[model samples]
Target: MSLIELHTRSLELAAELIDTVQPEQLVLPTPCADWSLRRLMEHVVGQHRGFAAAARGAGPDRALWRDAPVGADPGGAFRGSAAELTAAFTAAAGTPGRSRLWLPEIRDGGPFPLDLAVGFHLLDTLVHAWDVAAALGPSSAAGIAAAVEAEPPLAGALLAVAEVVPAAPADRGPGRAFAPGRAPATAAGSFGRALALLGRDPDWAPPAR
Candidate 1:
């Protein structure tokens, strides 16, 4: 499958997970340190818009990267942003000089290739979808996410990317791409190992609520 296909799948998975979030659960903490589930979602929605802008050569503008408010319908907001990104990326794939476009929000906004730009978003969607699932804990939402992860194509693509991303450095914390690495459990599957590579514990559950 294409990177766009994988990215779109991740976004869809994220939307489904978001749809399962209860109103009271919005304030719950997520794997991203210091960010509640709502706050983490704010960043995810903002990132979708920012990346969409970048695909169209307008990414240098910082305003698009601003944290958006989690409105009354978080799932709706997530789907909207995901759709925007999907359209932008589809359009960008055909646009002339797309390879020259840059994504400013990534590592000092270097002039990375278009494929890398999409890959970045794909990776974010994969990890953050897991974050949402983990926040929801052992529920229908998590089961939904786990079922999707069991698909070889999706997990394989994510694993391919995760394996290449180096473990987070000692200074790792909020604002960095990933957290400190954790050892994968002996019984871990491909998806579990992938999460481990991305500095998340597959067995993690929310604190007593």
Candidate 2:
């Protein structure tokens, strides 16, 4: 599918996941170490908002988008933020799509194309959504399949990043394994495995399972 479709799908999955967050789970710890479930939701929503601002040709400072504790229930906050993000993204994608962005990840004080920005958003939401699901427990994996399908660049980027960066000690976390310094290899198996290779695990299976 095209990047827009993929992004839309990711957003849809995000909406579904967000609606399920219970108040108690917000403070739960996740695979991301320091980020609690509430913090993770904040990160996810805030990032989407940042991306939306970017889609509108808004250049945002990193601090402006930093994660914070969720005041309301995470699910409700997520729904509001996701809607805002979707609107902004839609507005940006509606025109000729020639906006430039300042994404540090791509190392461009970018004047990047709109499609590229949306693709980046898709990749990010996919993993972070799964991160939240992991904290919530087992009923979360269904969204991973949709998220994995949304971003082709994630898989490709992982392979390329691995080829360039030397692998670290094997026990390092999944995220570290695909960092720029490691020359790792592409993983085998499903899209989930591919995501794992890139340092995002779709299987974030329950700790007990």
Q: How do the residues 4-112 of candidate 1 rate in per-residue lDDT, one tens digit apiece?
A: 8888988887787788777788988887777898998899899988888888778577797887877767898999989999999999899888765566666667777
Most TM-score-accurate candidate: 1
Over all chains combined, what TM-score does candidate 2 have? 0.71
The top-ranked prediction according to lDDT is 1
Q: Write the per-residue lDDT of candidate 2 for residues 94-164, one digit (tens) a residue.
A: 76743556554344347667766776676676656767777777567555554454555544432333333
RMSD of 2: 5.3
Q: CA RMSD for every model?
A: 2.0, 5.3
Clashing pairs in 1: none
Kindly provide the TM-score of model 1 when superposed on the true structure, using C-alpha atoms.
0.90
- Cα-based TM-score, every candidate: 0.90, 0.71
Q: What is the lDDT of candidate 1?
A: 0.78
> In order, how many clashes per candidate?
0, 9
